[model samples]
Structure formats: C-alpha cells, structure tokens
Target: MADILTVNGGSPLVGDLEVRGAKNLVSKAMVAALLAEGPCRLRNVPEISDVKIVSGLLELHGVKIDSTDRDGELLLDPTNVEQAHVADIDAHAGSSRVPVLLCGPLLHRLGEAFIPDLGGCRIGERPINYHLDVLRQFGADVQKRPEGLRLTAPDGLKGTRIQLPYPSVGATEQVLLTAVRAQGVTELRNAAVEPEILDLIAVLQKMGAIISVETDRVIKIEGVDRLGGYDHRAIPDRIEAGSWACAALATRGDVYVRGAQQLAMMPFLNVFRKIGGDFDVDDEGIRFWHAGGTLNSLVLETDVHPGFMTDWQQPLVVALTQTTGLSIVHETVYENRLGFTEALGEMGAVVQLYRECLGGSPCRFGRANFRHSAVISGPTPLRGAEITVPDLRGGFSYLIAALAAEGQSKVHGIELIYRGYERFSEKLDALGADYQVG
Candidate 1:
C-alpha cells in the first residue's frame, strides 16, 4: 500500500531545521567513487531514496559500502568490484539519472558497462542521446539493447572536444566522468556549471584528477593514469533550502535554515525578496521570515544553472498564489512541470495555461502540449483537497499548498518526497506543522 500524508492546513511552520548534503551532488559523487581505487569517505550525505539506490548499485558491483554511520556518512571501497549485476542495476536505472552516470565510471574501471533506462523528475523527456553521442565520440562502442544500453571501450577511452546542443546536467556529468580517465585532454564546451556539478568536480579533483573550469562554459580534464581515494564533505542542498524558504513565505512564519549557504541560492533569494519574504544569511545558515505586508508579483523563468532553477519554480509557484497581483512564470527546463498548477487550481488558485510562447524563445514545455506559461491571479482563498504527488519538487508544492489552504488535505505518494527530502515528515512536525503519516 502507498503511504499518504494527511495535513490539517492553517498552521504556521516555525523553529529551526538543518539541511544535509545535496541530493543532486551526492548520488553522482557516489558513482564517481567507483572510478577511483581504495576507499572514499563522504560526509554530510543526505538519507534520501536516490542515495540508497546508488549505495545498493555500488554494493551489487562488489563495492563495500556501509550506511550504518550516525551522521549519514558512507565509506565506499571499490577495489573488489568485479561483475555488474544487470538485474539490480536495471531496476533503479529507470528511477534516477545517477544510474546513467555510472555508465562512464563503470566503463573506466571495468572495460564494459551496461546502463539501464534513466529516470528522474517527470518534467520532460530526458533523452540520454546527448550522453551516448558524447560517449561514442570518446571512442566507446555503444549499442542499444532491449533491456538497456551496452557500452564497451575496447581500446580504452580517448578524449575528444565535445560541445553539447543544450547544457544538460546529466550529459555534462557523463562527459566529465568518462573523460577524466580517457587518453589526452578532454575539452567540454557548453557545460553545465551548476553548484552540484562544481562540488562533484571538487570531489574528483580531491581524487587526483586534473580539471580546470573557465568562464565561457568550458571544462578541461587531463586523462590521469590512476585516481586515489578521496574524503570530502558535500555542499549544502540549495533546493531543500529554497523549498523551506518558500514554505516560510507561504505560511507567514519564521524559520532558520541551518547548514544552507546563501551564495548558492542568490537567484532564489532575489525572488524571495521581491515577494516580500525577508531573509538574512550568516555563516551557519539562512533565516527566512514573512513580515506583515502585501506579497508582490514578480516574473520568473526556470533555466539550467545560475538561472532560476526548474525545481524551485514549483514550490515558489504555490507561494505565488498568496501574492496580491498577477504572477507570470515561464518554465524552460521541463515540459510536464505545469501539471502541478492544475492541482493548485483545484485549491482556488487562478492559474491559466498558455500555448503560445509568452517568454520569447521556444521552451521544451511550450514545444510539447503541456503549458509552459502560467498567469497566477492571487490573494485567493485556497481550500484543501486530496492531491497526489507527480514528482519530487511537485510533491513539495502540494505540501506547500496544503499548508497554505483552509481545511484538511490528503497528499498521496508521499514516498516521492523521500527521493530528495531527508526525514521530511519529521522535519515538518518539528516545524509545528499539523501533518500525520497514514
């Protein structure tokens, strides 16, 4: 039976909370550990579903992984990794993009690798064509099989200059992982410069990989003969931090988010400021509060990295419903992301979907049948209703909507939130939220 969370709305969340390692970076970093010899120690890891899936995959490949630590640290010993279990690998490949990331590292460690289907937020058609194309360019023999993708590097990996059609995060990570052990230097243009990617690069550098980052979206990696074990702490989760900030605004409460960095969330901080959500940053974490004032409407667009992130758009959209004026949002990352807006509209939010590109260039969402542009008419009274979580960030949006609504709300598929959030139900309870798991 699927677990559900029943929330009684009209309660404000208060008190302090701490965020751990990023869900985005930690998973790929686990896969990166497979590329190096000996044991690697990772600290401040978040206890999320995706991380568990990665740990399981590493153990299936004969890597020794221990999750019994109190602080969510993992020690991965990859020296004994022999055969990659296809059944175990294939089961989770379609659940997250991290499995696809393992393809490069596995091929580097053991000449052949099979990657099952890839999965993540159901926002768009995340095709691995760009990743496979880059892998083929690097001299890896790739073939599509009925079960999954089979890749072999007979002559080992040879580096080549690669330019991405779009700055896809997964594809960029794939190139970085594959090219690190390839022959000669690999230059990647139009690379994703997300903070999580930067953190992964930092971990790789600690493992004795020579890599440099340039301003023009160029990444250069020199092929290294062998990589040593690395011990590093991951960066704080910006997405979780942003979600809490939005939750604070939606409920008009004060919350101090510990372990959250301000620099990583500058774009979201700017938007929160415009929306009348007051926040202050210190060395430890960020503090969010909503003073007694009118919430304002601001235009938003979701881009890759350094731009407003696609994941932050959903939860913030729920907070936008409390704004006094009309709010315009353009989603550039995923096509089916607007499905959550329909759920919000059910709770009395005046959100209209548009087919035409209201934000200039053609977006993936607009290109598809799913509406990318949303006009939110707000200060509307929201009433709670039963909702199902479609994806990760969308699940948080439902939680935000439930928190802001007038009555009781039943949120099904609460497990989806566990894919990224760590002890989310417990955290909500700590914040004085009226929610119970059923």
Candidate 2:
C-alpha cells in the first residue's frame, strides 16, 4: 500500500465520529497484561499499529491472545510467558519503546530479559536513563549488550525509594510497571499523574497491585504476594479528541466527537473556548465547531498533566493560523516539536519559530537554543502545497492544514499517521473529506 494522500482542500469537515480508547493507555495496558498470571481482558482498544506492535511483542514472549466476537477487545493470557529471542523481539519492536518497559515484567517471570534499543516518534530525545536507574534501584542488574541491553535479577527484585528529575510520563509508567511486583514497598517522587497514567494505575489495581497516588506528585506501590488478571475499559483519548476539535476549528467545520470526555479534556477545552471555538458537552461525547466570528489568538504553554497537553499544541497551532491576531505557542515538553511548523509556512501560513520561551515563563529549552517556541499570525488564507508527514501529531496537523487550504496537497509518509490514529482514512471519508488514498 502506498503511504500517500492527495487531499483537495477548501471545504470544512462536518460529521459525527467516534474515537476509541487512548492509544497512550491501551498499549501500556496491553503491556500490563504481562504482569498477570490469569487472563486479562481489555476492552475498547483502538485498532492502531502500536497495538499490533505491542501484541506481536507479547506473542513473541508466549502470551496467548484470543479475540472475542465483540470489536476492539482482547483476552491476553500470560500463563506460559517465556523469554523471546532478542532478534525476534527486536524485529517485532521496530519503532516502539514498549520493549524497554517489558524488562521488569520479563525479569519477574523469567529472571532475565534482553531489550533492544527503543525507537519512537521523532518528537524529542526521550531517554531510557530514568527507566534504567529505577529498574536498578529495584535490584535489576542492567548490562549493555551487543544486541541491545540485558537485564538480570538473580537475587530477585526488591522495592526501593526513587526520585525523578522531571515528572516524565514514560519514566513514571516504567516505575509503576516495575514496582508493582517487586519484593517490598516502593516510593516514587515527582511521578506523572496524567489521565492516562491514572487509568493505567486503575488497571494495575484491578490486577491486584496496591498503589496510592498523593497530590504532591508522589506514588507508593506495595508489592503483593501474587497477581491475577483484570477486566478493564481504557480511558478515552483526549489527545485524539483535541486533534479532531482542532481539525473542526481549522476547517471552520462542525464535528461531533464520540467518546471525548469532558473531565480529562478540561484544560484543552478551556483553551479551545478562549481561542473562540465553541463546544457543547454531553453524556456521550463533545460537539465542536467554529462560532461564526473571527477566531481569537492567545498564548499557550504546554506542560505536564493538568496543563495544556503537549500533544494538543500541533494541530491547534494549525487552527491558530486562522485566528484574528497573533498566537504564541511555547512548547515546553519536546524541544524540537515546533519544527513541524515549516510545512504550514510552505502552505502560506505565517509561522515564525523562535529559540526563546515566548509564551509565559522560560523553560529548560530557553538556554538549549532549540527552536521550542512558535508565533503564528493569521487570518491569512492558506494555499495547499506538497507536504510530508513529520510525526504522528504533526502528520494530523498537516491534514488539518491541507483541509483548510485552497488547492490540493499531496501528503506523503501517511503510513506513520496510522501508528496512533485508528482507521483515520475511513473517518476522513465519513466526515466528507475530499481525499484519495494512493
């Protein structure tokens, strides 16, 4: 299949659609199944490439997976879990970071694990240093190997207190997955409490792990004698919901997004209203649309959970280009995330990249000289042009920009978009988009 899309722009996307489980949480929940002896059933899992990657990795490790008659559901049994060949694991885990997180559960099951170098989106440098450090504190012996990294726990893992320099979502997940089954109690400071992370905690709790979250970014996990399985429903994807909302705003369209919850999206929803986009919330989902007036521009800064999500910034930046005034976006999460704005500039958007922290307060990138900030000035009519998808969120941003533009755009590298988005082309067709798959 060709990874290309030719989109004829200028019309708005107006329709109803549904988003499945959070891709960020679903994959981690699938990984959580490895820690269970009984079969764990996960519902509302999105059909995305990342799920396939994690499932393949689990299958290579001898987890028996069977599907139900219902759509988007899986029963994963880790009863006969065994070590997978490093080469096989590497081949299955291409472009995914879940393999590293598997080390703890694999060690608990098999006493040793071999993990290949991780690969993920080109958003920023997401180091596994914190993961390795936390694993070591839990008594796993980490060694560099030719294939990748080998972790062994001969004396068995015992929990220990750990501190994180930054409240990273990945590192926090690593801690939770490893600390759940270790020997004693573990305390972690500066842990991430994102909605996805909290949902992951709920899944682990269902699997018989005792964990508590404190308000001051602290988490305590007490190791249990045994572990069972869980029947869980994953949280709705706020990132995908916000992306669709931005798509509607960018194209001056109306979209009813099913499964978009209000609580998790409160920060994003506030920003949406501030930018002059209107949304109505109900029990099922959210209805987002343009408000028939000039859209306002404002300052936005991305931070950890309870703040504007870093994932929401890219597509909204595209929407901001249709706003009335200047919109300043300070990307404090990933240093090079603003690099994708170049394509919008090519499409006649006035996006200026800057090295300084331009939104509210200075971040770590202020001294690193990375172009981590953007200023978008608009109400400028966009003209579609040839573009290549940069990464997952950035790829969706390209689609929004193309739909909001005048001419046609040939979007290359669209296969990367499937890594996170589930049946995106079908949804585009459902929303009456003028696009063709090549």
Q: Could you say which candidate leads in lDDT? A: 2
Clashing residue pairs in candidate 2 are none
lDDT scores in order: 0.88, 0.92
Model 2: per-residue Cα lDDT over 68-159, one tens digit each: 57689999999999999888998977779999889888888889988887888889888899889888988999889888999999899999
List the RMSD of every prediction in angstroms: 1.4, 1.0
Which consecutive 10 residues in model 2 have the weakest lDDT in total? 356-365
Model 1 Cα shift for residue 149 (angstroms) = 1.4
Query: In angstroms, what RMSD does candidate 2 have relative to the true structure?
Result: 1.0
Structural similarity to truth (TM-score) of each candidate: 0.97, 0.99
Cα error of candidate 1 at position 153, Å: 1.0
Runs of candidate 1 with Cα error greater than 4 angstroms are 361-369
Off by over 4 Å in 2: none
